[model samples]
Target: MGASFFSFSFSMVSFSSLRSSLVPTRMMGVEGQWWRTSGNHWRAEGRDDRMRGENEEDSKLSLDFTSEEKMEIESIKTYKKDLLDDIQKLKMEIDSVMAEILSFESAEENKTIERNKQFSNGKKKFNMDPKKGINYLVEHKLLDKRAQSIAEFLYKEEGLNKTAIGEFLGEREELHLQTLKAFVELHEFSDLNLVQALRQFLWSFRLPGEAQKIDRMMEAFATRYCDCNAHVFQSTDTCYILSFAIIMLNTSLHNPNVKDKTTLERFISMNRGINNGEDLPEDLLSKLYESIRNEPFKIPEDDGNDLTHTFFNPDREGWLLKLGGRVKTWKRRWFILTDNCLYYFEFTTDKEPRGIIPLENLCVREVPHPRKPYCLELYNPNSQGQKIKACKTDTDGRVVEGKHQSYTICAASAEERDSWIEAIRASITKDPFYDLVSVRKKKVINQTPQD
Candidate 1:
């Protein structure tokens, strides 16, 4: 009798393919003798003792191989699991790097925008000096001499006495100077005080159906005096009436003694000398006084010394409700429109603005809203047909990038909305380059021979 033996081998293979190729191949083995001692039983005969020993050895080898194969399978499974974990970590790192790259790109874009703005502003710096540019207009005869007189009054130039005021008022200098002097004395107002009062009156006065009258008068004044308008002076009478009204309001507002306060009767009495002894319409006076009484004019403590407080000014500052960017909610903010920039604050008295929006390359229009009335929107017309982002301010006191391509604001009434839209549009065009171009064009026209 002879014992049988078997041998086995394995090779490295992919985990997925290992299962399919795991079948053991057949191998030659030593022959062994077998005899039947009972039904379905095989046993070595007594004389084949050495063969039995060999058979036991073969059995041990088979058992050892099976155990080793199981250990290898477990090791391969652990390696696969570790590989998957490393792949997951690599993916996360890649995502983090991508985020940082996007952040850098956004910052670079903002820097470029800021540099361009500075360059544009530098070119317009000389034009922005209202005093200098206005003087030039007067010398070149683009504006009336009276315009120069008004600028002198606002700038508080040396020798700006009552005589100068009379000069600015032209033929009616006597009555106008009397009224202005009396008003100034009654309120103990300095030239600076008067300037601030005029600003407060303009910002706070609003009468139903009469809003356009004030706007038109101011437009005429700006055209004649501030060089902010290109059109010829529409009406000197309108400008005179506006100046008188400002004086009367300053008298009405500034007296500290409540007992001697200027009443509507006093207001009417003081202004009766205007327009050649004809009184202002009683109805208009009554309404204006009522509005002022209801909301007494007071300049914010912070804006007391601002140049915009003067009459030869181009600013529209007040409170308005602005829509939030991320929250999509309405918030009341104090807004100031001046010098081709729109700035907003959390409160009217805040010394520093929360953010500033450049008026360049921007347009404002009234838009219909589903849930809110008297809505106006500021947006760039060159957005290439994308929905504009809402305006928002970051911690650095500038508009956050990728946040505001547009701003939607709400006013107290439709008239207020329209007024804001008009003011914003006017500011967009009120630049030095426009003023020079207007003057040159007027010069060319005047030099041409009559037809």
Candidate 2:
């Protein structure tokens, strides 16, 4: 298939529009010293001393577990690992067979191929009789307006040495390639209307991050998910519309909460009787088209990070530019800062943590007059025992610089930097019991009344 026919529009918003749309909101009700257990679960240890004293007995009594219960827990753990392994195997099989999944070529594609063959034959004839072909091309207005100047330059200036003519044709090919790229960009921009509409739906549910995540998801879907480079579609509009449905279906499958009406499961169930690629139900396709166009998005609350129940009470979570380890290039990463650790996500929409940085025994300092002004440094006490992929080290497994591993982190602004720095430091030196004592003093003072 020709590149023009095969290419489907992937919409993208302007940089200014994107920036204006996604403004990070301040995290609310975030203050507290959270307790981390060995199981990596976070619990509210209580905000003050009086609250801690009240809950102490309840906490201590919960720690007792019987032998039978412990054995049952071990069995469940083993079962979970087995299930995960099975899931990995299934994913591998899907990836391996993706290329071999046959999809039929349409009548339109066959017609396009025929047209291309005729065009190639015409090009061959044109090369043989240049003068007559040029006059005919001009009369028919078949040539691109941009190609006129190049043609004039080639014949008028550079005389027809076979090498010079070949070189000129190569330049013409480059121009055509550039023109194709421009068409792609134009189509993408035009499709931004749909993208913006989709963004509105996401933002209506307060899921701006989810909307952004879809862009990354689409990129992965286009470039990595399908092994086949060529996607078969009836029309260009149908192509992207179906792609949107696939994305929605993919997201629905991954989410456990999407169980009922208007779900991907329902769509799949309706199409269970038909073959996958060969005979897709037209009614189901119509439903999907309507779903993408008109249906109101029902984003699950679980789309956002649930750090409240985690071992670390995440104070802040947002997209930040992070420098690469090997390439030393900057790229955006979803940063989540907890009391004891800093975690990064591949995308803001990702549920899995990509990397973790323990703040234990690390020094936080400001970087002055750096490439990015709003930057801070985390100096690890020693890189010997710590595993940080970004840090360059010696063969002896020590940091190349010295004993410590220093990471430079950037925030969106100076104010954000200060807040991050303060939160990180407070978590590092925070006395979990200090609040308890302060609360007790306040209670005592209140009990004394007007003295």
- Cα lDDT listed for each candidate: 0.50, 0.45
lDDT digits (tens) for residues 1-451 of candidate 2: 5654445322223433423442223212123433333443323343332234435533432453345544553464366457657777998999767644532245567777876665454445444444444344444444444654435433333222322233223223455334322322222222233333333323222211122222332332333212222343322222333445443443444434446435544554433322222334566465554555353344324334431111113257777776655456776778887656777777778666666777777867777644778988777656645544333334454544322245667889886786577557655643322343233333433342221
Q: Which regions of candidate 1 are displaced past 4 Å?
A: 1-313, 384-399, 431-451
Cα error, candidate 2, residue 67 (Å): 99
Worst 10 residues of 2 by lDDT: 203-212
Candidate 2 matches the true fold with a TM-score of 0.25
lDDT of 1: 0.50
Instruction: Quote the lDDT for 383 in model 2.
Output: 60
Model 2 residue 111 CA deviation (Å) reads: 77
**RMSD (Å) per prediction:** 29.0, 47.1
lDDT for position 377 in model 2: 77
For candidate 1, which ten residues in a row score worst on lDDT? 1-10
- TM per prediction: 0.31, 0.25
